[model samples]
Target: MAGDLYPDHGVTGTENRQYNREQRAGKHEADAALYKSHQCEQTPHPGSWRRHDQRTQGPLVAGYGIYTQGQEILLTFSFCSSLVSGYVITYFPLRGRSETIRLILSDQGAKWTEEEVQFTDWFTANCEHKKQAVFGQLPKFKDGDFVLYQSNSILRYLGRKYGIAGGSNQESALIDMVNDGVEDLRMKLVRVLFYEPEKGTEKYEADLPDQFSAFERILSQNSNGTRFVVGDQISYADYNLLDILHVHLALFPACLASFPLLTAFSDRISSRPKLMEYLKSEARKNRPIVPKK
Candidate 1:
C-alpha cells in the first residue's frame, strides 16, 4: 500500500482528528505539573534543590548535571518528527513519557508552544562554548540547565523510570542484547545508504542477501507464528526491530521484494492503523531522512 504512487486511503481526516484528540488529551496530562506550578506562581520544586545537590556531589558528565534545573529536556535529532521519538519512548517507556514527551514538547505537534529550533541550531546555540560538548552528536537530551548525551543511556534511564526494562535481570539483559543487535545492524545499514552513497549502496546491495537471511533466521527462531518480536506482548525489541526493518524497506524497496517473509512482516506492521497514520503524517510533513545528508 505504501509503495503505491498514492496511498489508497490517503490518510483520512477522521484519522487526523483522532490523532489530534489523543494528542491534546495527552498534552494536558503531561503539562499538568507545569501548569499547576505556573498557576501557583511558585519557584521550582524542592526536588530541584535535591537534584542540584546530587549533581554537585556526584560525577558530572562534563561539568554539569545531566539535566539542568527548570529546563525542559530537549531530545535533539535531525528529523524531530520521525522514528527517533518512537525508539526513545518504547525503550524508555516511563511515566510522562508518552506522545507529549516525544512529540508535543519537541515542536512536532499541532499545539506545541516552544520555539522549534533545528537540532543543529540548538546545539550551536547552547553547547558551542562547552568544551566537553561533543560535535556530530545527536539524540542528546537538554533540560533547562543541563544536557545529557548518549542515546542508549537516555533510553536506559527512561526505561528504568517507566519500569519497562524487564521484570528480571535476565530479561533486561536479553532486551539489551536484542536492542544492541538491531542498533548495530541499523547503524551499519545507515552508514552504507547515507554516509557513503556510492560505496555504501554497493556494499549494501552486496550484503543484502546475507542481511535478510540473518533476519529470516531470527524471525523463524523467535517468532512462533505470533505477530510480535518477543514474548506474548509487544516489547521495545519488537518496535525497534520493526523500525529498523521499515527503514531498510523505505530506502531500498527492492530489498523487500527478495525476502517474502520480511516483506510480508513489514507490510503487516505498516498496515496497522496507528502506525500507518503516524507514517502518513510524517510523509505529509516532509520530515527529513534519518541521516539528513
Candidate 2:
C-alpha cells in the first residue's frame, strides 16, 4: 500500500517489502514494550501475540494468537510472577467442570487450588494459563508444570490415584457408565443453559421425566437405590452425578421428586460432612447455579 501510494518515492518492490516488514516488526516490538510498561492493551485480531497487561499479579497473565493467510495459529505464553501449586485447574469462575473437580479435592482433602480466568483477556494473553490445555478448553489440570485436559479425564486420574475410583474393575466399569450418563445430560443442559436459554427451559421441562426416570432406574437397580449411585461407598461417579442433580434441581425444583432414589441420593451426598461444608462455603454460595442475566 505504501509503495502504491507513492509512485515517485523511489522505493523498489523488494525495498517496499522489506520496509513494510520492518514497519510491522517495529509496531509489534513497540506494542510489546508499551504493554510491559502499562500492563495491558486493546488490539484487533488477525495478528500475533496480543499481550495481556493483567492487573492481577500471577503466573503467565495469558497467551495470544497469530493469523496467517486467513488461518489462526494459537500460541501460548506466560509471565510467571509467583509459583503456583503443583495441582491447579484454571477455568472461568463457574461451577461447571471445575466444580466437580473441586468437589473431588474437597472430599479427598487434596492439596489443590484454582486459576480462574477471564474471557475478555483470554486470547490477548496468548492462551495464557490454558496453553497446555488439549483443545484450549477450560478447567485444565496443571500438576506443577505437567498439564492435563478434559475435565472427566482429570477427575478419573485423580480418582484412580486417590482410590475413589473403585476397588474392582467391575466397579470402575459401573462408575464409567454413570459418568457417561452424566456427560450426556451435561452436554444437553449446557446447550440449554448457555445458548438456548429462552426456549430450552420449556423443552428441557418436557424431557425431564424421561431423563430423571433413567437415573431413577439405575438407582433402583442398586439394592433398592438406597445409597450411593454404585457400590456401598462413595465413588468418583457420585461427584459428577451430584453436580448434574444440583443444577437440574436448581433449574427445575420439582423434577427430582418422581425419582425418590435420586432425590435421596442428592440429599445424602449434599449432606456429607466435607461436601456439606463446601455447599455452605463462600465458593459455592458465590457461584450462581445458572448464568445470570
Candidate 3:
C-alpha cells in the first residue's frame, strides 16, 4: 500500500514509478543496468526490511519479486505495524496456535488482520460433506496474494523471512529443537485441556517442573545462561514457546516460581522495547489468550 517497492528500501513511490517509466522508455541504460545488477540485499532483521544492489545476486525489480506483483501483493518489506498490507489470518476466536503466529507479527511491529470463527461454523465450512477448505483446518493465513496453512509451517516461513531463525545454521537447529520441545509439552497440556478440562489446572501444575525445566535448560545453554532460548535473540521458537508458557502462567499463577531463570526470561521477552506497546495495547488485549469455553 505504501509504494511499489519496500517503503524504506530505496526510492519513494513517485521515484519508483519514474524509474519504472524510465526503464520502460529505454532512456536510462546506466540506471537500468544498475537496477539489474545492483545486488539487492535483504537482511535477516526484525521490524523492517532492507534491500539494495551490491553487484551480486538478489531478486531485483526487473529480475525478481516485490515489483513483479506490485500493489497486488506486499512481497517486499515495509516498516509498518505488520509486514504487509491486507494480511488476514482466519481462525477460531481463541489464542491457540494462531495466536503464537499473531504474536510473532505483532512483536515485529507488523500490520495484519484476524478473522475469528466459531467451531460450529468452521465445521460447517469444512465438513467432509461440504468440503469448503482444501485442508479443512482453521488458522488459514493470507498475505497479499500468498495464502498459507498450518501453524508451524507459517511460523517457520515467517521466521526464515524475518530473520527470526537467529541468522545461522546452528541457531536455526536450536530453534527447531526448542520448537519441538515446546510442541511436545503443549500436546501434554492439550491432552488435559481436551479430555480433562476439569483437571487442566492441576495437570498443568503437575507438569510444570519437567516440561518448563527443559526450556529453562535450553535458555541456560544459549548466550551463557541469559535470555531467550536460542542465540541470545528472539526466534520463531521463542514466540511459540512463549505462547505455551503464557498458557501455563494463566492456568497456574505460580508456574514459574521454581524456575527463576525462566521467570526473568519471560519478563524480558514480554517487555521487549519495540513490542511492549503492542503487547499491552487495546487491540492485543481484546484477543484473550484462552477464549471462554
Candidate 4:
C-alpha cells in the first residue's frame, strides 16, 4: 500500500493534543530538578536539556543522560522538541510506515501527537488534505513549521535531528545502508500484503531463510552479535529493522527459527523500558498493521 503512487495517509487536526500547557510546565519543572540532581555540565533550556555526547557510554544514545559506574541514568530531556511542545505525526489510524518513527520517538522519550485521518475522508472527492500534500501522499511529518513527506525521508530527518542517525560518518553510512536494505525487504512485504496476498505470500514465506540471513549476519558482524545492528549505540536503522522483523513474525510465526541472533536482538530491543511500555499499550496494540480493505 505504501509504495503505491498515493502512499499512506495523514490529517490536519490539532497538533499533539495530548500535551497541554500545564503539563508542559510540570514536565519542565521536573526536568530542571533532574538536571540539578545530575549536576549536568550544560545549562537547562526552557523545557528540556541537551543531548549527551555520543562518545559517552550508557544505555541511551540520543536522550540527555550521564553514565555512572556501570549504570545508566537517562535524563528525559529532548532538546529538539523542548522549545516547542513536541512533534506531531499526521497519518492514517494504522501503524504502517509511521510505526518506526513512532518507535524512535517513544524510545527516546520524546513527546509526540498523532493526527489521524479516517479512510472515508481520505478517499472522498472533497478531501482537502490530498490537494495540500506536496506529493499528494500521506504519512506527512511536521516538526514545528517544517513539514516533511515520504516516510523514510521523515525517518532520516528525525534520525539526524535527534542524534540517533549514527555515531560517526562511517557508521552513518552503514546505518543508511541497513535502512535501505530494510526498505527493500519491506517493499517486497508490502507487495504481498497489499497487492498479491495469495501467491506472493507463499513465495515470500518460501524465501524467508534467504531474506532474513542478511539481518542475522549484520548482527553477527557488529559487536559479536551482542549489541545493536550497526554500532554499540542504538540507531534509527535498528528501529526500522526491528519493526519489519516484528511484522514478519506476525505473518510467519517460525520466521526467525533459523536466526538466533535476530531473535535475541528482537527480544533485547523490545525489552527497552520506555519502548516496552508503548508496545504493550492500547495505542500500539489496537492499531492494525494494514487496513482491512
Error of 1 at 172 (Å): 2.4
| Candidate models: Cα lDDT each | 0.45, 0.69, 0.65, 0.75
TM-score-based ranking: 4, 3, 2, 1
Estimate, for each residue in 1-293, the C-alpha lDDT of model 2 and write its tens digit: 22254343233446444444334554455445444464433344554433233323222234343343343222224332332325887887678888888787676554467777776666666766656566878778876667788899988987775667777899899999999999999999888888887775887888888887888888888889888778887777889999999988877888887787898989988888877888899978887755444
lDDT of 1 at 113: 18
State the lDDT at 43 in candidate 3.
37
Instruction: Compose the digit string of candidate 1's lDDT tens values, residues 94-154.
Output: 1111222332222222111122234455446464423343544444455323455555555
On lDDT, the leading prediction is 4
RMSD of each: 17.7, 18.3, 9.1, 11.5
Clashing pairs in 4: none
Output the better candidate (2/3) by lDDT.
Answer: 2
lDDT of 3 by residue, 1-293 (tens): 43554443555546544444323434334433343343333333333222333221111121212332121112223322321346688887777878788778777666678776777765663444225345666678887777888788888988876678777887888898888888888887777777677764665677579877788887778675576787766788988887887788887888899998888877878888656777677766776665575
User: lDDT for model 4, on a 0 to 1 scale?
Assistant: 0.75
Look at candidate 2 and tell me the lDDT of residue 36.
44
**TM-score of every candidate relative to the true structure:** 0.51, 0.67, 0.71, 0.74
**On lDDT, who's better, 1 or 2?**
2
For candidate 4, lDDT tens digit of each residue in 23-44? 4454555664564464433433
Model 3: CA > 4 A from native = 1-84, 125-132, 198-200
Error of model 4, residue 277, in angstroms? 0.7
